[model samples]
Target: MFSSALSVLALASLCAGVLAQTYTIFFDNKCGRGTPTLVDQNGAVLSTGGAYNFNGSIIGASAFLQTGSCGPSGENCCTLKINDDGAGPECTKSVGTNNCPAEKCSASGGNLVIIFCD
Candidate 1:
């Protein structure tokens, strides 16, 4: 009975791990000569470039962007929402003079690309 219980526990643990989902946020800063900031939904600066991966559970969580070498108080920041539907890999300038368009998320993918600038 002990052996069987251990097996069940192990299976449960494995299942939990398998059920957990992770999503990646790809940041493309093409603003020419400025460093971009990526902020999480809780107003935390998660990263400043390239990419960031987060737990898939934060479905509606958003990441805000600050372009240029504006440090933390920069202007022209944009917002990108976290989605796990694999629908996007899109771009949108939430708040900026930059002319980037909003892209839709993919339906079966976990990769989202946010483009700043061109």
Candidate 2:
């Protein structure tokens, strides 16, 4: 019985690891008028524009664009939310001039491009 319980625990651990998925998020800022800041689910700054590897459990990820110098002092900003969906990767802007619609992921993990305009 003791050995059987240990085997079950080991199998469960392996299954849990297999079920945990990781995604590579690419944030592209095409906004000509501002500097973008990427924020994760916990409001931690991820990156400006590049790549970030995130666990599948992240939620409420967003990106903000500062129209001035691209920092805390910048004014007139816009917020874009990153949606977690199995259908594809999606991004939606709450405010600002969006040049393109939300991008979709090509696979389970893909890039999300945010384009802003004046």
Candidate 3:
């Protein structure tokens, strides 16, 4: 009986993990230079926050940052704060402009595509 109960408990844990979801912000450098920062609905930096890796010259660099959130779908749209890295403020759409579309920040697949538009 104890063994059976233990097995059930383990199964439940596994299922929970499988149901867990995460989100990734796809940053674009269409304009010039900028980085996307993830913030919660309350205007706070997400607990699990990090920057994306940039490649090529600074003029045309591009990358994406990722953040993890186990919250519900509708309650998980993060505020993508766009910061134009000295390339003219508001030249991007991910940070300065609060117009980046929100999508399910999925664990398996990436959500929302952000870009720096000049």
Candidate 4:
């Protein structure tokens, strides 16, 4: 019985590891315009939604999933890196100005919503 319980515990640990995946997002503030790109550790696009807009332009400015402003219709599930190229507004409003310091992780139906924010 002890051996059987140990085997079950081992299997549970293995399954738990397989269930969790870590993704990262980087915030670029060098450019006034904060461009968020999502990629996997292997750098892949999980969402058809484009680039997300981090609010520098307007308050109601939404965090789109892709290149333009999109609603929930926008949240492309990709790891993001911020390129701080001097442009539009000012990306630095907080510490996550260059990296996804604020990581948002959500688990749903074996899928995860990992959000990176500057």
Tell me, by lDDT, which candidate is best. 2
Listed per candidate, the RMSD to the true structure in angstroms reads 4.3, 4.6, 14.2, 14.4
Which regions in candidate 1 have their CA more than 4 angstroms from the true location? 59-65, 68-76, 83-108
Q: Please write out the lDDT profile of model 1 over residues 1-118, one tens digit for every residue.
A: 9999999999999998887666677766655544545654555677777677765344444544443434353334445555444333333324543533342333237566665554
Q: Residue-wise lDDT of candidate 3 within 68-113, one digit each (tens)?
A: 3312211242343333333321213234423334422211222334
- On residues 1-118, what C-alpha lDDT tens digit does candidate 2 reach at each position? 9999999999999998887666666645554544566777676788766676665544677766655544342223446667666434566656554433332233344445555442
Segments in model 2 whose C-alpha atoms lie over 4 Å from true places: 30-36, 65-75, 85-89, 96-118
Report the C-alpha lDDT of model 4 over 20-88, residue by residue, as the tens digit: 443322233332333444433243442332433332222112222343442232243222223322122
Each model's TM-score? 0.64, 0.62, 0.42, 0.27
Assess candidate 4 and give its lDDT.
0.36
Candidate 3 error regions (>4 Å): 47-110
Better of 2 and 4 by TM-score: 2
